[model samples]
Target: MKRLKLLVTLAKKGAIGEKVKITLRELADELGISPQSVLRLLDEMEKEGLVSKEVLGRKTYVEIDHEGLAFLESLCDAISEALYNGVIIGEVISGIGEGAYYVKQYAHLIREYLGFDPYLGTLNIRVLFPKTVFDALCGVRPVVLPGFTKDGRTFGDVKAYRIRINDIEGAIVVPSRTVHPPRIAEIIAPVYLREALNLKDGSRITLRVVKG
Candidate 1:
């Protein structure tokens, strides 16, 4: 697994089947080993049908094979599954009042991706030390809604992660991009979360975010 991960780090330009220009010395530096050690690892991987390498002059081009990609996919899935099943506890808070507008505008896309029509607004949560939760959530694949031009303005993509709040189905919504702060997350559910959970500002709640 460590060697496979090292090969994945070496293929930085793209995924399997995409050409990447990398050198054994660079790989050794990245893997914290000798160039000869990298060569041995590459030989082992090539024998196992995981990678393909070519030598041209002093440069080496590397690419991962289908089998390698499949293995990586499985590894990612396992990691995501392990990390995805966690609890997030936070205090309910008031948003900037923009949730209604965006949620209403993107209702169709949200429903299409999340399989449920969302309530008109969001439930804001102020988390405590949310770095781990944020990283784990970001590690998994998110349901993305493509941006579109509306009212002479272009709205960016939105990402949603299926979640459950006290056993009620919901999702965490990140508007625009993946570069969000770890302090807060906006949640949307099929019903009004505030009313459903009898929540108010300063109320603490627990959420379960799942990947599969």
Candidate 2:
């Protein structure tokens, strides 16, 4: 698991150079394992394409490939969401913040100006991808909007995103902005939900309650 974690971390960061790279010997020393053992693990990962290996003269260079990246990106999200719902995020950022915008699209946010260590975990966000945003986008593409407001406004000016999200669980509607499981669905941007309801464009700003 240690070697796998190290490999994935290095690969995801593209920690390679023109000369090719191998596991850092310092890393092996710290992990209390010989470089040979690390090599064996890399060999196994290479067979799976989770790691790619190149034999150059007397050295073996290994790095993460696309498959490994997908896995880690998924991991980053799972861990982040778990933290978000588990004793981490202090207050319900009920106003517009990052989650309401892009994580739903790029699966990553790219801002570094915020004072706090920007939550670097993945959002457990899911988009039902409604007809509006999907239809309007150039490729009929689905995107997560980051600029949504907390009091049920929206991610952006165009609330036509087909992105519907659960605002309720089992039998009850979620109370706005406290803490709840990602599964419970209380804390959602109102705009995205509204679009999914096929609203009249500028109708009664009521949250479109979906049948959970």
Task: List lDDT for all candidates, in order.
Answer: 0.81, 0.40
Q: Please, what are the lDDT tens digits per residue for candidate 1 over residues 73-155?
A: 89888976665556678889998888899899989998888889889999988875344457548656788889988989888
Error of 2 at 103 (Å): 30
Per-residue lDDT of 21-84 in model 2, one digit per residue for the tens?
6544754775568877777777777787776778777765666777777777798777654433
Consecutive 10-residue window with the lowest summed lDDT within model 2: 84-93
Question: Where does candidate 1 stray beyond 4 Å?
Answer: 1-84, 177-180
